[model samples]
Target chain A: MPIGFRAFALAGTLFAATLPAFSGTLDEVRKRGNLVCGVSMGLLGFSEQKPDGSWTGFDVDFCRALAAVIFDDPKKVTFQPLSALDRFDALKAGKIDILSRNSTWTLEREAGLGLLFAGVNFYDGQGFMIRRDNKAVSALELNRTRVCVQAGTTNAQGASEFFSTNSITAELKTFPDGPSTLRGFETGECDVMTADNSGLFAERLRLARASEAVILPDIVSKEPLGPVVRNDDVRWYTLVRWVNFALINAEELGVTSSNVTEAKRSTKPDVRRFVGVDGADLGPKLGVTADWAARAVAAVGNYGEIYDRNVGSKSRLGIPRGLNQLWTEGGILYAPPIR
Target chain B: MMVSAYPALLIRVGIPAILVLLLGGCGTTIDEGVVTPGALTERPATIRNEQLIGKWGVASYRDEKDRKRVEAQARAQCRLPYIIAKGPSDGVMMHLADDAKLYELRIKGGSDGKTYLGPEAPPGEWQDREILSVTDREMIMRFVDPEVHGRYGTFIYVRCPG
Candidate 1:
């Protein structure tokens, strides 16, 4: 076939393929009777399977919140564990309604792949971990140190850029994957090991002398991790986006699962709007019931509750809030008004 | 002849009218209420302290239906008006989020062309309050800090009748 005819044929095929999804993912999910959520195979604190064959983690709670919004029951969801390489492909193939894995919202991933990141649920970044005995307070102190990084990952480049920009010279040692790189660090092959700050926290739990190693406070790259959906469904995209915003807004409004019942009776307009006593149109506008936000909050609590339960001081990982803190409290996290 | 002259008439009268309508559309677009992303780059907006320094009635609400009732309540408060005093500096005296003491706040402009009233920091800083809409008889403001916004909601000031 001629090149022009082939190009036209591909365009026509693409248009036809996307036509059905544009109608909406919400209707399909409703008909299916459950939300199909894509998540990691197992990443502790973010997403991990328990002994009971049920999934639990920060990412898992987001899907639960979505399920609550749709079905008014958090349990109305199926977790589809996916590898990093196949995550986007699975979403594109219509295998999952939403991907709640700790995937970075990068320009290439959104534009190149036909996907849209809902909103940044967690702000993560490349960070280095070193032995506390080294007495290094920051990444800057690791000048001329050997840094272990996973091969074929962005951590090596992030480490190199940080060192070069700060006028510090550090040698980067590569390992095949996260476990081997961590092993290399533990066996004294390198002075430092680098990955995403979240990954470092998860890996540190597996360390022989976990308390002996410390994750440096410095973040070398911007990694705004969020839930992703296919770009075809605008209504579903809006629904997912606001579910995240609703969680953040609930935290801002001082509404929690414990006090949500009391909040419904509050005279305050914003509180009333949040608890669904007011702004009855808001939920239906998102293709859910009037008390969708209230249900989600009751199911998973607010963003702060989710963070504290899964990853923050309350969790085993015990990661600091850092940039994940609310914008009012000197952190960058902010959500637009519900009204 | 009338048909031929219609084009000339359209050029003379309709074009300027269309221009006016387009300009009016642009005016409403300025306050789309999209949050300004980063620091302000344009020059700070000039809101004369004299305009704000007056005895005004103040009330707050999150819902639109409560606006009229709150406006009435604010007007009634004019018996003992909420005062906005001229600061020692060129700015007006106002309280920051979670602050008890009043500080001098300037009218800062964002690159997106929205006006904010806050301290010396950038517009949309934690201390700043974006001027949602302001006029001679009424001025509305919302806190830039989400915590403060959550707690206080939007504030409305109605000018006390002389």
Candidate 2:
């Protein structure tokens, strides 16, 4: 062989040797007694720590939904609170069985990080909140301003792109996380702070006075935050993905947490089958009990039930269903049928 | 010629635009706490436009018919200051109000979390200088400043005068 061909052959051999070994995470999780779920440290509407230190939020419910399918008990799961920077790393390192944090699935994240997103649980966007007095009517007016953004998130990239797209430039200041980012904006260290819209809704609570702030009319990015797992675990990924599907299908079928028991008595064959009152070997398909979905619905709730109890308007978190609503109701929340 | 639904435009452009708004930055509270002035969190555990809290004639309005009809009837029976407890967060976000000085809208959710008042006095995200109009049934709020000139007209609020 010529010298160049020999060099190429050696490089290919080295590349093949560099690939990481794979393991069946799904199988391991089944063997383990409880499922480990990674949740956000705190993001009011989407994920929040209750006063008793129990994790409750839309994202947290997603983990419970997975647990319900795997063990027939939604409560049999652990919530691991993580900062934004640590969320991805924790999964890559196998610190959590599943990362159900409000993490966006972006191109760079999918290709760069050695992880896989099960699916989108929430569709969110990013926007600006300015002190009304700044007279900062639009982002175009925000030239030469300092912006506070979270490090290791799409927000920083968004800030850079928004300014550049508008032909305006901003001096960037980064905080390791959201709380610090809000603090930086408050102390005048930066003129603006940026994050997901849902997070912005939550951070607004900590402000000295609520009226001093205003969210601009424009939004900048598509953040499909969802469940994540290590790429090596295909089985575990299926379990999680299917659980989410069950929740979505439950809502589509009009089965709610409050009415789950009634649904058990439902004469509707599809529903009876879903609630585990009647069905084929659906649980066998996922290595779970037949009533796994029913147990989850009983323990936590369906997707809509989870939303109402945690981030719903009545909850302290107060998130609107928005794009998270079911497809039947004209929102985008469509999931494939579990059966 | 009327354009078809902007599917391509929405996906290509509107998606990013909405996401940009959703990811917009931090804000100091306009109103927070149990007794803080301008604190949005401090507002009544519930909020209804005090004036339009009664059953009344429905005309050019913002609320959807089904919910609005129920709200109107509730006001008639409950006397002024009627309570239309927002629904759970799984469906349409029936907007209550988006004011010029105060945008007080209600969406379906399990609880009322923190809310931020836009920086301007007459509500809505956009700023206005020369617009002031209010009515028991419907009002028009507009801005005439060269920098901001837009009109949100015929807003309907039922009367619930105590």
Say which candidate scores most in DockQ. 2
Q: Name every residue pair that clashes in candidate 1.
A: none
Q: Point out the worst 10-residue segment of candidate 1 chain B by lDDT.
A: B1-10
- Cα miss at B31, model 1 (Å)? 81
Query: Quality of candidate 2's docking, in CAPRI categories?
Result: incorrect
* Candidate 1 segments whose C-alpha is farther than 4 A from its true place: A1-21, B1-162
Candidate with maximal lDDT: 1
What's the TM-score of chain A alone for every prediction?
0.92, 0.75
Model 1, A179-238: lDDT tens per residue?
899999999999999999999998998898788899988888999999999887789999
Chain A vs. native, model 1, TM-score: 0.92
TM-scores of all models? Answer: 0.64, 0.55
